[model samples]
Target chain A: MARGHPAGPTGPAIRRAFDLLDLFTTARPRLTLSQLARHGGVPLSTAHRLVAELVRWGALERDPDGSYHIGLRLWELGALAPRGQGLREIALPFLEDLSQISRENVQLAVREGAELVFVERIAGTGAVPVFTRVGGRFALTATGVGLVLLAHAPTEIQDDVLGGRIERYTERTVTDPARLRRMLADVRTNGFSISDRQVTTDSLSVGAPIHDHLGQVVAAVSLVVRHGTASPHTLAPLVRTSARAISHALARRR
Target chain B: MARGHPAGPTGPAIRRAFDLLDLFTTARPRLTLSQLARHGGVPLSTAHRLVAELVRWGALERDPDGSYHIGLRLWELGALAPRGQGLREIALPFLEDLSQISRENVQLAVREGAELVFVERIAGTGAVPVFTRVGGRFALTATGVGLVLLAHAPTEIQDDVLGGRIERYTERTVTDPARLRRMLADVRTNGFSISDRQVTTDSLSVGAPIHDHLGQVVAAVSLVVRHGTASPHTLAPLVRTSARAISHALARRR
Candidate 1:
């Protein structure tokens, strides 16, 4: 029998499926059946059925410990996303260059709806430890990538971010809406942004926008180095040049 | 109105859903609705319905040009795959080291089922262009990472590969099952594999296995360089050391 209303649109069921998948995140990479049931807000039977289906389809896998985790099939499919793997593949050479030359943490990110998702990151062997993970989400006010993304976001999204809770990451993080707005304007005008000891006490990041053929900021590239070692001014040009090259490469693909 | 399989097991429906997703490979990144329907072997109505569901959930998205492609959400979920992003994350540092020091193509890969899927690749600036793509699949009988993985695969899989059609990329590629079998034995004995112009005409790759805490070969790392510039013997130690470092790092995580 059908699980739900037959006449109703399939939108809700699809959303529910996505919600179930979303239950597994970096923080909770693996979960038991009961845990998934509770987190997904589905009945035990429903959770069991869906989980079984997902596992069989390879969207999820049951580990040796019997906990469910995202599967390789999902990752393979995700590699097809232009904004995710496509962007990362194109930007990787430039990101690698920056990471190797500066010996710093290099990151590439894109704005997804209202959040910024790290597409790729290259950590320098001797670079300061920073809090960034690939495929992880972060706020749009504190990070160099975030500032570049926030600066170019649509008006409504910009308003929403500035109007919402601005979580402070460090003592130097700018949380004031007016100040953040001004900083975003400067990012647009100056062609780069400096998040000096913003996300962490010891890291400073310089970010620049990577534009599409239409010249809209589609992504951001950043070089995060140990604070006090080099000025953001010196790094801004490097970041901007990489971003421009990425933009040029992307334009050529069109 | 549950369609033809209203009374059949739900398993098939889920399998068909996955089958639809499986149709999008690196070679076929985008497809029209009819193309997807035909490839998936689902009726137009059913394919349309499932496509609509997937689209709603962001598992798929319609490109600006009106073609459907895999979505960012799928990539985000895929990033959670341990075999995919997990291995890449751990090996990235060591791979970066190899890339920087050698100034060549650094690759990380894992064997999924019987095929070698490239997990990550770093193309050195001005380095010889290699044919490998991240998330793309290659034969288990060719390339450096493929040899390492093939050497470690179960006996049945090894036998099946040896008995099957062996596509040759170059004259140096070992299509003779007997020769390939001996090469795999050598890889297991030597702790590394050398693919001397096997995949392409002008490139050579040296690969080594990355073991886990349990000493299982979980992944492989390689360096691809121009054939004439550096001998595989010279690159073997560097790749093996990096692979060992990655293994140590992964072992600590367990």
Candidate 2:
């Protein structure tokens, strides 16, 4: 379950089946039988058997080109995940309001272990381009939403991320452990976060945490814009208000 | 997986595993072990073992309340499905425009077997509330989008549907095979479909087909408004234009 690696030591048959699925990513959505056999560590015969079962089960789909990808059945199962589309459905209207008001990019994210997975993203017309896809994972250090999530995460998770080598995306990205810790603390105290050109040179983002009824920070919402076009102070109130609205919606639902 | 059954007979283990997954739906996203054992038609011990493996592989998550539901990792895998979120991503902007202009519920759907699965739905502000959920399935005979997709489906699929039982949702639903066949042919000739109060007495919808680069009808887009508020004639151009725009987006991406 760690990125491209197979799931930890289950029986080989189950592990092999999951490994074939784990081989797919946003960058590589399709795989040939040989690719599955080679990368998934199964023989061609075994790969064929497993794939036959998977396709029949609707876990994988065969294209007209004879390549395989994840199927609509898996997507239906995914929509039931509360942290995924369930949360996105409840948050979308508020995200739309923020996007329309700012005419910029809006994002919703949740922490999955020490990493963050984008749950939803909306880019306004003529907004600065952002490289984000729903269900894609990112490091805990670089982006505004990432920082806010890391700030509000459990202590064990914070320790795990802070104790590791931080991946930097741009020169403005804070890599030093002590400095990054200070930034997280600022996020908690200031009730928001600002990542200025941390992920990309032209982009800066302001993020705020979304809370559940229990007051746990279940998610984060952010606004990303061209760095020189807007100040973080100007965007902070907007992002914070939207995040609060989403949190209230979630609370009411719960 | 006919609505609510176990996956086909592959081997007991794999079929049981998939059956456990297929147990989830929008109406029932969470389940206890007893529920899984009973509904999934597996022994309690087998269900527990399968649930463990599924949880380890991130296909299911155990909630704090001791119930299990679909997990975010599955969502990550689902995002790779070209027919699901991948298609939704390309069509969303067009759907958004249509929703805003018409101030009605806009939907995108694709055929999965003889059934239609909704890929995306955007509800307009002040719009009549709709019950459709993303990734949820519906009969191909019920809605405007369903009729459009069923019309373009393969000959065998059409025969299979026409030869079987068609469930009617409202008094306006056309249940006779000949009438339904004529309606489909009209859809092909007119390049759009109108379902007047078929799914619900208060709702009427207009649907148009979306094609891939090869000109195959890969999806359908529709706009649903209150039956008394707007005629399908008034909505056809908007739905068709939006569907065409989405088709162009898919073509360009391909």
Q: Which tens-of-lDDT digit does each residue in A65-165 have in candidate 1?
A: 78989988899899999889988888888888888888889999999878899999888878888678889988888999999999999999999999999
Q: Considering the two chains of model 1, state its CAPRI-style docking category.
A: medium
- Candidate models: Cα lDDT each: 0.88, 0.91
- Give Cα distance to truth, residue B129, candidate 2, Å: 2.9
Scored by DockQ, the top model is: 2
lDDT of 2 by residue, B142-198 (tens): 799999999999999999999999998999999999999999999999999999999
- Residue pairs whose backbone atoms clash in candidate 2: none
The candidate maximizing lDDT is: 2
In angstroms, the error of model 2 at A221 is 1.0
Error of 2 at A239 (Å): 2.3
For candidate 1, the per-residue lDDT at B53 reads: 82
Residue B227, candidate 1: C-alpha displacement in angstroms: 4.8
